[model samples]
Target: MSAKLTFLGHSGFLIDDGATTLAIDPFLTGNPKATMSAEEVRCQFIALTHGHADHMGDALAIARRNDANVIAAFEICNYFEEKGHGNVNPGNPGGRIDTEFGWVALTQAFHSSSFEGRYMGMPCGVVAHIGDKTIYHLGDTTIFRDLELIGEIYRPDLVLVPIGDRFTMGPELATRAAEMIGAPRAVPIHYDTWAPIEQDPAQFAPQGVEVEVMQPGDTLQLD
Candidate 1:
């Protein structure tokens, strides 16, 4: 009854708390490692950290077909609504939205926010609380000092981070990020999508942090 976390490749994740199903960043359709297509994905809620195409991939299509609520930044939410999906809950950094399972807090993430040439400002990460477990997904960002502040505030059980270079923090910075966030367990994502961002998880795994290198369609149970 705690929560189950599933990695859907390249910043995509599916979370189920037994009561509610939530998908984060449905970048599955075009991803080589992705297991489910846009039409095949099922969820009650979809959480987006930014407006980038890769992160927002197939979200609209999936949300529309599944009739799921989409959670994202204000501008991104409006954009999705304009696209004809009105079930969007606009959130900002430091804001919280109540879901069927529990509350999901919008946290700060240092990244650009734009989708299809449109400037959708205010990208953010999500701190979701379901049952007794709290999870933090860092979105696409670099290593920042305020991560210690976020860790102090949420005290997450599991942390999902991007280890892809060129756009996000690679293994070196991700190692520092893991230390800053102070999460019990950390998983690396957003890598190997293309060249210039390829990385080996073994090189990133260090002491004191339970580093889980999850493949596409892999499931991790949090109890």
Candidate 2:
């Protein structure tokens, strides 16, 4: 099977690349748009972009239930281990970890990383190469000049970005990010979860790029 991406509300996503099933930032339990419960979600690997409650929500619970490996920054990994989840891949920015399916590279993300009164390290994004396709998930971040470099390095086929302002990039900046990333297709995320970060996807559809405005449970097939 080709790489399939499903938006799981907020910053959460389920990615199936035939060999391995991966979930990212599982904030579904409390999210209104979430389709699956923490128990209903299945994945071989659970990747976190940061240590915020919203981003790391339901991660330990879901990973424990499914016996999945949790991937995140070193500081966040320590927190997971303290919670008795030993299967953690503590990675740093610019590092790549090998998984059963492919390689996942930790990239820089302009966001804070703290959760549950605990302070983790810096936040990060992910560049995953599965089969012939490369996917970029920009976990709660702002638009940066290095995005152009990331685009040149990974040349991702699909990019999952945040269009929710207040905390992350809004529609206007996110549109510029799409161009900077130069991905074939881009999907908006982390919007409409709360009043502070509400945004409309249509306002961020960049010209010449395939913009997919997916709802909570919508799934997209990646080439």
Candidate 3:
């Protein structure tokens, strides 16, 4: 079997690559459109792209319960570590950290970072190589030119993009982002979770790119 990636609603996902389970931006608890809860999640590594409450949802609880390594920006890690999380892997943009599963490389994201008014660190995107595939999760950000550079360097097979306009890129911009990254396949996330960010995934169409509109409980197999 290849790797199984389950969409945990919003920007959250669980990737089981036979050897390791990596969870990214698991914001299920207070997510209005979420179909799952943090209690049901089990992963070896938890990767947070930013410091928003929605993006950081249930990470501490799930990490504490599963003894998973929480990976995020430097200050974000410190925040969680001080909050009693036993394991924390701090990282920064333009750097890569190798892990048992594979590797996670940080990239520049055009966004802000803060949690409850506390500084969390620079918001960044993530390039994760797990199981048999490579995924580029473009955290919460507007369209930027660096995405092309990331794609050129990593050559991710699948890409996850945020299509929510108020806080991130809208469908039109996200479609352009897909073209810039040149990934074979892409998934639309971080949309339809609230009123301001609500978007229709079908409306986003990038030429020569296959867009996967994943539901809250859907899973995608990549090998």
Candidate 4:
């Protein structure tokens, strides 16, 4: 089955697999490059990588509007639940949860997780299997050695990585990471949205790798 992946600027994305649609890091309200609003997103599931505002922005609003389940770490889900947004699937790194569309596995990420000074949970890398395709979204983190292991385990067709410096891996590191993961295709995110992470994404060319730099609201279809 073919899947439609829409870039929502920054680290946000909309993944549609015909039967089920997932909104990941739907942080658009304050996003200057956001092409769509929170109310416009139609999805059955919302997957979060961590608790940072840039990644978790507008999650509650979109999930509440679509009545979608928010899948993330235990504390993150519990935080959403306390806010009165039900249907949160809480899981931790190394475990997989079968969903209505497919399955999601949480992997380890080297980062911090917190919202308003409240501990959200350990940061994570989300591995999603939808429409018979696997995608690895390495949430905001540095390039770690385990990515090679993650590649061996999931063998994702596409990998979404951060190319912003200071907060996450920059172009060179990201390029090396893509090679380590051995994904056939890669997309750059979490940069150029703010001054702290400003970057020229064109420099993110990975050696011997296909790196796709999608504009905000651009869609990539894979069969």
Task: Write model 2 residue lDDT over 89-195, tens digit each, in one string.
Answer: 88988999999878789999998989877788989998887766788999989999999999999899989999999889999999999999999899999999888
Over 111-214, each residue of candidate 3 has an lDDT whose tens digit, in order, gives 99999999899998988898768999999999988788888999999999999898999999999999999999999999988888888898788888888999
Candidate 1 structure quality by residue, lDDT tens digits, 69-95: 999999999998899999999989999
lDDT of 3 at 92: 97
**Cα lDDT listed for each candidate:** 0.89, 0.89, 0.91, 0.92
Candidates 2 and 3 compared by TM-score, better number: 3
Model 3, residue 39: distance off in Å is: 0.8
Better of 1 and 4 by lDDT: 4
RMSD of 2: 1.0
Total clashes for model 4: 0
Model 1 lowest lDDT segment of ten: 200-209
Model 4 TM-score (2 dp):
0.98
**Residue 209 of model 4: what lDDT?**
73
TM-scores of the candidates are: 0.97, 0.97, 0.98, 0.98
Cα distance off (Å), candidate 2, residue 103: 0.9
